[model samples]
Each structure stands twice: as C-alpha cells, then as structure tokens.
Target: MSDYICNWDHCKFEGTKNLAIRHVIITHAPPEKVPYFCTLCSFRATNLKAFERHLTTFRQHILLEKENSQTKEYLQISTESYNVTWGNRNCDLTLKNEKYLYPEPNIVPVLLEINEDYTVYNETIIESTASQTEENNENIEKLKTKHKREMNNLAEYIIRLEKKLSARDQEIFELKRELRCNEPFIQGFNEMWEDQVRDKKEQRDRKREDWRRGKVAKENMEPLGETFSSPPSKKMKSLVKKLF
Candidate 1:
C-alpha cells in the first residue's frame, strides 16, 4: 500500500494511514472549537480572566516551538494537590500535546501562574514541586466527578423549566386560533413573540449541550432558573387581561 502523505498546510509528514491519522489528531486537530479547559473545575467558565491567561500561555508555548527555542525552562506553580505526569514521566512544557488536555478524563492537569513578561506562559501543571506526586490524582478525579454531577442536575432542572415554557407558548397559539383573532396587529405580535421564544430556546439548547461537553463559556453558565421563576403564572395573568 502507498504511504499516507499529510498535506495539511506546511506539514511534510508521510507515514502509514494509522500513523498519519494519529499525527493529524495530536498535532493539528485538537478541538480548537472548544477552548482549552482544565479537567477539574479549577478553571472554568466562572473564572474567565484566569482561564484566558492559561490560553495566552498555550499560545506562547506554540510560539516557542515555532521559534525552535533550545533549552526553554518554565516555573510551574501548582494549584491542585496532585502533580501531573506524562507517559510515566514529568511533563515537558516543550511538548505541546499535554497529557491532561486530552478529554479522556484519564489525567488531571495542574494550574499555573504566569509571569508578566516574556509573554510568559501560564498553564495547568501536573508535575509538581513534590516531583510527580501520583497519589493526589484521585483527589482531582473526585472533584471532577462531583462537578459533573452538579452540572447535570442543573441542566436537567433548566430543561424541565424550558418544557413548561414551551407548553405555555403553545397555549398562547391555541388561544389565538380559538378566538379567531387574526387582526393584523395580533398576527404580527404573535409572530414576533414566537420568534423571540424560538431564539431563546435555541440559545438555551446550545448552552446546555456545550455545558455537558465542558465547552461552555462564561455567560452561558448564568443561572437561567431565575428567568423562569413564576413566569407561567405572570404570563397567565397577562393573557387573561388581554383576552378580556
């Protein structure tokens, strides 16, 4: 069989099909759509500024690789209790494909504080001052598990609230049809209301999915339960006042 030639941009990699695919995935095809995130809830949508600093560090690391910097050194400040290890060894920042950044939940990365100059890099470090403290990995895993459970509960609650809102919207449409209130103004109002609700629902759906996948941004995590609080009751009162 012929070798698989990777022609992605300036990449000159040639290998077997399996190797070529792996290279593409590890080198170029990280889910760039999903912003880089820590496995633990240590850095998430709630802490936008700090998480952004980590991203800045990621870019700096990529720049270093491009420049072919030799013997680069970085200080890793550990925010988590555990030390991150890569392939049975301490992580080398020069290696861009960090073991913890992968989504598999197999590794927990540590958080770092970046310096102000040199376009200094910040990241979640796994290898620590304790020299790869392997025992604390379980603590990271426990935190992640708890975080996932809480988020799932919140998502389910919001979904139930959305269902109630949808049902109320349907009742409004039925009332309009039953009253034969096809006045131009009424029709226009109904259309606008439908459009608004549709947009809101779509936005909520997208946010829910992103939250589930741990790819959500800051604003998307806002507490939506407040938006639905007694909305149905208030809408019912308004609907009656309008109908009469």
Candidate 2:
C-alpha cells in the first residue's frame, strides 16, 4: 500500500495533506476571529462552503410593522352649490306640494323651473273676466276640474320616482360603509417551520463535531498491538526452535 504523508511542520497527519494545512491554519488563528458572520444571529462559520450551508439552514425573517395611516380626501360641496342643486330644487318641490289654484283667491299657477338634471316643476294660472260671463262658462269650469286632476297624477308620479332614488342612494351608502377599513392585512410568518429547521441544523452540527473529534483522537493514538510491540521473548524463541 502507498502512504501519503503530510510535510507540514510538526503535523503527523498522514492521509490528506490539505487537512493538515487547514488544521495548522486554524490552530494559529485568533479564537474570536471566525470567517463567516450571520447578520441575523451570533453564529459564525469556519469556511465559505460551511458559511453557505449555514445560511441555507439558518436563514431568518425580519419583522417590519408598517403604519396604515393613509386616508381618502373627498371634495366638500359648497353651501351655495348645495342650495342650487338640492336645496333650491326642494324649494320648487315645496311649491308643488300645494298645486291647487283659484282665480278668486289670486293664487297663480306654479311656473315651471327646468333644472340641469332635466327635472321640470310646472305652474299654471287661469283668469275669468266679467265680460265673458256667457253659456260656455260651465264648459270652462269642467275643463279646469279635469286639468287639476291631471296635475295631481303628475305630482304623485314625480314623488314616487324621488323616493326610489333616495332608496338607491341609501343602498350605495351602506355598501361603502361595509368596504371601508382603518387596518389592512400584511404578510404572514411561520414560526414553527423556522424553529424546526433550526433544531435540525443544530442536531447535524453536533453530530459532525462529535465525529470529527473521534477521528482526530483515533489518528493521534496508536493501535493496541503497535503500542506494546517488542522483540520476541525466550518462550517465543523455544517455540520457533522446536518448529525448526
């Protein structure tokens, strides 16, 4: 068998020349000066390959809490615009609340106001003169009664439409309330998985250290027969003489 001996000074390591060189290098190095530093933990590695292995097994996550402080800014409608749009519109609705008109009472029919939203509020007035007091007066009275009934029907139809719109706006408001929130969900972390990985790595490192120590001890101590070996005694000489 061929023997490969290490040529390093005072190094009796006989198998791998590189292992002896590494041992000598580590022995002279400062105890506190380890090669790889883990930014997440206190663990340090001896070599680049070990450092990379350590990183893969001992990786950790950093927790960061972000503040959810942003809020939506909505335009506030001016009072004047509100009055012209909704309030003033209601003023005309109030006038239409009492649509009946009488010539003797000087109650003029409501004048129609056409709004930007295409809604029209109407007013109509009629007058009877003393000179036109003829037989057609009764027919005119019938016409007035018919017009009044038609106006009442139109008013009720508009009111029902407005009520439906109000109900739709209420539904929209409820949906918006349900969707609004002050806090938002963030990314999750798994503590149990990280802990398991850490424990497994620790077990592997401990076993490796124990195996290395045993190998070094075996190399340094000689075998039992080799340690006690000597020249043959008188009994060994007689046995050899008789055999001859």
Candidate 3:
C-alpha cells in the first residue's frame, strides 16, 4: 500500500495512492477547474476526461463563435426561454421579484393578516384541547372508581362463598362424627336382639318335646288297666260256690 498525500497547500487529505488521487481529482481539484480548457465555451478543466464530461454534460449551453477574437457564450437560462424549452417552469425568482420589486408588495400584509387569524385559531384550539383533556381526566377517574368498586364486590362475593363452603364442610364433618359415635351402640343393640331371639327359640322347642312325651305315657296306661281287670273277675266267681 503506497501512501499518497494531497499536494494542495491547505488540503490535509491523505490516503492510499489511488484513493487520495481520486479524492483530489473528484473533490478538491475537479475537472472543471484547471489545466484542461475548452476553447469553444471558455470552460477550464483539470483533465481531458473532465473536459469531455463538461462538453457532454452542458451540451445545452450555446457558444457562438464570431469572426472577432472573443467568442460569446449565451446561456438560455431566462424564465421565458426556460419555459419555452422545459415547458412551464415555476421558479422562486418570480415570487421573490413580486415580493421585493413590486409597487405594493402584497404578501407581507396578507401574511400578517394570516398570522393574526392563526393566533386566534390556535387559542381556540388550545382552549378546546384543554377542556377535552379535563373531561377525559374526569371520565378516567370515574372509570377507576367503578373498577375499584367492582373489584371490591367480587372480593366480597368470593369471601361469602368461601364462608358458605366452610360451613358446609363443618356440617359434613359433624354428620360423620355422629355416625361414628353411634356405630358401636347400633352394633351392640343388634347383637342383643339376636341373642334374645335365639333363647326364645330354644325354650319353645323344649316345651314342645315335653308335651309329646306326656301324650305317649297317657296312651300306654289305658291298655295296662284293661288287662288287670280280667284277673279280678275270675276270683269273684270261685268265692260264691264255696258259700253255697
């Protein structure tokens, strides 16, 4: 990399050789300025490339060569000629000329009147904006209050539901406790009733067996008494013959 410095006395631009040359050629010593001169348009340039570019670029500029020593260059830049060539060009020069050189200079007084009107319009806009801002603030405050109230009501409703749930849970707990407390008593009562029923069944079965045995004994005694009565009858007959 070769370091190249600018040769211009006041220019401190420096870079690599190609970059510095381009910078100097393009920026500081442009082609329209120095050693390259165009005899046709009396335009000076630094290089042949610059001269060729200027010739191509400003081909619209007319250079009239007279038989005299001096050549006259005419730039057709007047407003009428620009309108004729470019068609209806609007320029600031015409407005400036109207404002400055006219006998009356109509724009400043009209601008003053507009400024006064704008001041009144701006005040009215500011007053309306202030009123709207105040109204918005009041509406926002009311909405905030409504939101807080609704949130508080929701919280209270939640609390009430929680309390009711707690009460229901307590009721369920008490019912379970009562069932547990009565379970042993209920079991004992059922066992006592079963024992009483078993004892009554055994007593009834013993009374039935005793009644059956008594019936059988009564039937056997009736048959034995008949057999004894036949023996007694023979004895009576023998005694009566002896007496006779």
Q: Highest lDDT among the candidates is held by which one?
A: 1
lDDT of each: 0.46, 0.40, 0.45
Over the stretch 1-244, how does candidate 1's per-residue lDDT look in tens digits? Answer: 4255544444555555444433443344323211233442222221234444543444333344433222323322223222222231133111222222222224344423322122212222434622333345456668879999999999999999999999999999998897685677778999999999999999999998988778556556767778677356887899999999
Question: Which window of 10 residues has the lowest lDDT sum in candidate 1?
Answer: 92-101
Local accuracy of candidate 3 as per-residue lDDT tens digits, 106-196: 2312110000111101111145545665676678779989999999999999999999999999999999999899999989999999999
Query: Model 3, which residues run further than 4 Å from truth?
Result: 1-125, 186-244
Model 1 local distance difference test score: 0.46
Candidate 2 lDDT, 1-244, residue by residue in tens: 2123323234333323233223322332222332333333333333444434433432121111122111111111111111111112222111222222211212222322222221111111112322233335556667879999999999999999999999999999987776564213211235666788999999999999999999999999878896568677899899999999
Stretches of candidate 1 exceeding 4 Å from the true structure = 1-135, 180-244
What is the TM-score of candidate 3? 0.28
> What count of clashes does model 1 give?
5
- Each model's backbone clash number: 5, 2, 1
Model 1, residue 39: what's the lDDT? Answer: 41
Between 2 and 3, whose lDDT is larger? 3
